[model samples]
Target: MAGETRIWTPIDYEADGKQSDCLRLPHSTDLSAYGWVPIPLVCIKNGTGPTALLIAGNHGDEYEGQIALSNLARETRHHKVSGRLVILPALNFPAVAAGRRVSPLDEGNLNRSFPGDAAGSPTQMIAHYVCAVLIPMADIVVDLHSGGRSLDYVASALVRPGRTAEEHEKLLRLMRLFGAPISFISDGTGGGGLTTLAAAAQEQGALALTTELGGGATLSKAGLALAEAGLKRLLKDQEILRDVAVEPASPTRFMTVRGHSAFVYAPSRGIFEPAADIGAEVLGGQIAGRIHFPDLPTREPETLFFETSGLVACRRAPSLTERGDCLFKVMADIDVGPDQVSHA
Candidate 1:
């Protein structure tokens, strides 16, 4: 597998106007002798302006972003665009087709495979192309995401800390404009650059933002609507699509992930019974949940408590969970003005 060498693509970014094409990734299988995996992409260009990379489906089980981006690609007109817009609704086609979070070909989570190997598995190749070809061509990137099968979350936008004063401001500004009800500033300690696409985008010096709209292994109508509305507003905010009407930006609550304390993980394999609800505020040391051992009826269920006092931003969806699984995570409110953000 070539590392940083050039890779072939079926879509032309500079072709001009509106066009839909697939990124042909070479793959050989038992069913087809010289078959190639097709990644759907759409590019719309009107005149000279910045390029925006709009993407979804990094995790195949997340459907809100994929549906919204697909509808956007199909409905957007080139004449309405002042800059370039490239849409990739499904980056990991194999995973999406299989309804799994990671690609079955190599068990690769595309979100965690950034700066990947060129001649690696199908998932890694896609990640490598994104790092090599896509990021360099983008001025801004908006990656839509949500909690996958094992979890559910309140709608929110996420940004990593450690950016320059100017870059940080721009990042939060766009995230506020996203209007997802909650604006989250990541601790940067949980997931590093190579582990998440959001960090990868920031490493490339492009303004980046991601979201957690909804989850539970099912799509939410409200979440889908929110994604579509935010996608259009973000493009208009960037002036990529001129004359597009934007929805009024509602105020978003600011929150910070306070390292490991912000999350509560399952201690032993059991059925989870949550005490606090999503979006609800709670105090530290409060009972977050209890794990019941179904097999051992005589055993007392283990109780889990909150590590920090904050809002319930996310929770485990499936009742039956194993050891090492995350049970719930909290985010504390803070202050964020137009020019700056600080913890309250």
Candidate 2:
């Protein structure tokens, strides 16, 4: 009881049919001393089998995952499911409601708050409930994501390499089955790596998968279609969905994000003029883009170059830039082999 989460849900996770409810996270504010934030939750159970925990809205501005999970929650019924399906379409309800990447309540990034505290902020409480409660009940976990307002991604599915070779293989198989255009084998060492939901799930022995569908704080038609189709295929293949007719997975290119060289950052605050588009293949030392000072039109624009040769997997969406802002992220093809399955 020392580390128990304060959030409580009325939905019975073991029930035979579908149940929808809200996870009540306490928010003691001036307006209402007894107020609670309602985080939407849907659980579908049919007998006993493996459980799949699907989540989205870790970053609120990411639209693809939010829409996909919302559709799944609305469309799916208990009769169609062979096992259990737990859907958390908007995990960070505060951020999702504000349409922001971080929660306005405490400016907390849900993705960076795993293994969270029971006595922490609202975001941490939600994260604690997820890792301590939901993840343990899952055989597999799928977290959908996108670039949000700052960047645009070339639709890709990512998996964190497991601790053992056998576990790694299982994760790889699931990534391929999702059938995104690109399969990324991530070492999970950047941007709050170990604190991510994927990492928490992996540490708990649950096969975890994440995706980057699209970005720019808007819905992408292509990204939405891929999310819908891939989710159905994954569920059916895992035998969680019984009667769904899912199409065979298409070919996915294997890739990985190497070292710091894979990223391009803005050197100073200026307007960014990109030289390469998202998904463009670039060589090392290639001119990535230029930073222009609008105030000093007479001065020359400072050009930036790529440090690694690879495909541009993500690019900054906004033209206005700031110092140290990530302008580009490049990904290289992974040489699939027995020994090269996991990156160090």
Candidate 3:
């Protein structure tokens, strides 16, 4: 009880049928001392079966997941489901409403705030609720994401390597089912590590998957389409949506993010000129981009190079950047052995 979340929901998760409500996160502000922030929730249940938790908008700036999940919440009906479907279109409501990557209320990044404290900020509270309540009730969890405001990414699905080989294989199968053009494996060192929603779900014995659809704070048509189609396919594969027809997933190129070398960061504040686009193959020491010092016209532009060889999975969207800002992230191909070819 000491570390339990303070948030309360009006809808009963155990009850059958379709229900739409909000998780009331207590916020004692100056306008209304007892007011609560409403985080939208949708639940569709039919009979006994596995439970799937679909989430998006972990970062407010990411639009693909939010749009896809919202459409899903509206279109999916209770009768169509054999098990339970839990949809959270905007998990971090404050950030989503503010159109920010982190919550405006507490400036917290939900994706980096998993296994949160009960008495933490609003974003942390939401994270805590999901980890303490929702994840335990789920058999599978999907957290949709994109590059957000700063970066643009090749539409991709990702999974953290599971604790056991069997678990890792299952995660890979689910990732392939999502059907994104690119499937990458995270070693949990790229960022967030165990603090991410995927890690939390995995720790709770649930298979978790995440995606990077598009970015620059704009809607990506390809990303949205991928998100929509993939969700349907995943639901069908899980036997949750009995009435929907889903096509078999296409082949996905497998990749992996090696340590810090996979990232290319700006060395100084300046305008960046990209040397490679997303999905471009480059070798280590190749010019990634040039940072121009517009203020000092005479100064030679500093050139940045890739530290690792791979495909450019994501790149900064904004031309102007600060020192240490990630300019590009390269993901190398996964060397699948003979035994793992069947999954690919």
Query: Which candidate number maximizes TM-score?
Result: 2
Candidate 3: tens digits of C-alpha lDDT, residues 27-50: 888998999999999999988999
- The residue pairs in collision within model 3 are none
lDDT of 2 by residue, 1-344 (tens): 13888899889998899999989999999998999999999999998888999999999999898899989989998998989999999999999999999999999999989888888999999899998899999999999999999999999998887678888888888878889999888766756677899989998999999999999898999899889899998899889996887888889998888878789999999999999999999999999999999999998999999999999999999999999999999899986543443231
Q: Which residue runs of candidate 2 sit more than 4 Å off their true CA positions?
A: 337-344
Per-residue alpha-carbon lDDT of candidate 1 for residues 217-301, written as tens digits (9 for 90 to 100): 8998888988988878888888987687878877888888667878899999999999998899999999999999989999999
Question: Each model's TM-score, in the order given?
Answer: 0.94, 0.97, 0.96
- Indicate whether candidate 2 or candidate 3 has the larger TM-score: 2
Among all candidates shown, the one with the greatest lDDT: 2
Residue 155 accuracy (lDDT) in model 1: 91
- What is the lDDT for 25 in model 1? 82
Q: Positional deviation of 282 in candidate 3, in angstroms?
A: 1.0
Arrange candidates, best lDDT first: 2, 3, 1
lDDT of 1: 0.84
Q: In model 2, which residue pairs have backbone atoms overlapping below 3 Å?
A: none
**Candidate 1 — which pairs collide?**
1-119
